[model samples]
Target: MSSSDHPNISGSSQPLLHQKGKEIQEFGTVNQVPLGLSYDARLYACQRLNRVLADTRMLYSLYKKHHWLMRGATFYQLHLLLDKHADEQLALVDVLAERVQALGGVAVGDPRHVAELTSIPRPPDGVEEVPAMLSRLLSAHEAILIDARDAAARVAALGDDGTNDLLVSQVVRTGETQVWFLAEHLVDTPLVRL
Candidate 1:
């Protein structure tokens, strides 16, 4: 190796690797952000938003799962619907995470962490009956809608309109629409009346 081989290289240039450091910002804490929100408001919004983010991720995973395992006469329709819902949930996941970051708080990103924080129950490993799978989805959506409605109201009371709008406009509305779709699938309507 010649010294002139690399013009910008200093003697013994090695990349810094395997670096470890203490946590800069712990979970459940917020930084000092001048976004016109008080500390309590920011912290409260972060806490609520992170919970919703976790559940949204879980719901996305569930949608993917059910979509893959979907079977029967409605399989074709369900496969597409579940996938569409999953994509929307994934988008919400990003939006929720960014909202948390914007509030100067850490967004829960790890699957393991999300599993811990999510209120949604885990479905069985094996496929359930199609009705059961749809029921599970409806249940998850209901859980999220319940929390979202409460959180939206509380955050609005705290004077955090952005978070309130996100919870109500995006989370609550999407959840309600999806639940309506899923619930209809369980209806005992005859395609051809006798």
Candidate 2:
């Protein structure tokens, strides 16, 4: 006649905790959380790693699309530029994915997930014009590199040794290189300034 009479709540139907325990036993225990840091630190590292991985994917796709569609103004140079940019981005994808796995989180592979999670903006529609495409591409890559640096700093500050090491030794260096390459294109160079 009372709520206590309910089997589910009163343990008559086996407590929810017990049921969950049984289910976990049947499914096998989940991965153990890594030690050596506060929960806040670990959570911060995971989120930072996720941010970098998603941004890597978004930037890679933009480079590839722009490579194929780019036209006008220094056509050969821009063509080669986009292609090389795509290659650089492709290399970063592997590093970011590995970092995500090392941190105990799944790397985002689905384009939908990348789009949903990435802070970077999508390339504007029908942006086949070369200078315009180059401008957008530069901005996108710069934004991505900045996020990578920020995430690296966050992970380092949280004392995630592995992520910090990876970030310092490779990720940040490559990102800076790519950013430099993209930025250099925008500088005005005189044909005859001698």
Candidate 3:
């Protein structure tokens, strides 16, 4: 067949791969936006949201790990609960990332970048006892909740209502509910009275 008959198969063109270039937008800088928010407000909100986004990613990781590692008497229930919670956290990650972008800042995309930004402590590589694992999740939730509270207040003060609403209405509320669920699993209660 003539090369012109199958242009796609011609040896003249190849796919672009392994391309690298300088970053167009630097991290920690916000572009001017016309969302009725001042540049400073947008900048501050993006900074706070990115920090929470990083921690939420870590929390999501913890939930997945614990969900898979759930064992002992309440394994089935705890496993299902952790997986559900993980899914919720995943949803929050997307929402949080988009919020940062809406503020005209770069959302931290790389897992390595998230690791560098997250304040949540790294857990052991091995599986922990069931209660210990549950406790670890609660601790992660606590960290996120604390940050959410502070960030929400600061963003509100900065006149970034959208960011404030997201931190309070979504981040804080979700973390608090998840914490309640995880904490209940650690209580010394039997499935039924002996």
Candidate 4:
């Protein structure tokens, strides 16, 4: 067929029209799932996951701040370590957010939203000493670990196996490891004399 014979197919190559759809789901609500869990279970899981997500996001921010503000004899080491932990926490943030969404809940995206959701205490705006910074990081990690452990147990009891697995395998494990590393930095052991 000649180009003119296919007028419908060659209609100036314009893009297809689109329209914005109305919001179908609210932030605090969940859609039905066939995972065999009760509505109460999914709702509870999402609430717990959202809390973890908030704290994880805050922890990631602390890591970045400490990474930039690092200063001491171990500056290079701590700087690199904090950046690495930040990246790890960032990964956990994504996992937690996705888990919340999979449970049909909206993940908090804004920093202000996270601040409102998170229970982690806000740190000073300016730079803190190296020990103080490391201590702060450890404290954040512990807070997350404690919550994840409790949530995992409760979610598992509620028959939300997926959330339980995520809390135990990813969130708790990562937080515990990071806590160990940060806590070691605060040890008073002498490098050479002791």
**lDDT, each prediction:** 0.94, 0.70, 0.91, 0.89
Which residue pairs clash in candidate 1?
A: none
Give the Å shift of residue 176 in candidate 2: 1.8
List TM-scores for all candidates, in order. Answer: 0.92, 0.74, 0.91, 0.88
List pairs with backbone clashes in candidate 2.
Answer: none
The global Cα lDDT (0 to 1) of model 3 is 0.91
Shift of residue 106 alpha carbon in model 4, Å: 1.4
Q: Which segments of model 3 are wrong by more than 4 Å?
A: 1-14, 191-194
lDDT per residue for candidate 3 within 31-117, as digits (tens), equals 887899999889888899999999999999999999988889789998999999999999999999999998899999999999999
Q: Candidate 2 residues 44-139, lDDT tens each?
A: 666676677778777778887887786667767877877887787788788777766555556667778778888888776776566567677677
lDDT of 4 by residue, 105-128 (tens): 788888999999999999999999
Evaluation by lDDT, superior candidate among 1 and 3: 1
Cα-based lDDT at residue 91, candidate 3: 97
Clashes of 1: 0
What ranges in model 4 sit over 4 Å off? 1-22
> TM-score of model 3 relative to the true fold?
0.91
What's the TM for model 1? Answer: 0.92
**Better model by lDDT, 1 or 2?**
1
What's the ranking of the predictions by TM-score, best on top? 1, 3, 4, 2
| Tens-digit lDDT track of model 1 for 3-88 | 56764467746654687999999999999999999999999999999999999999999999999999999999999999999998
Better TM-score candidate (1, 3): 1
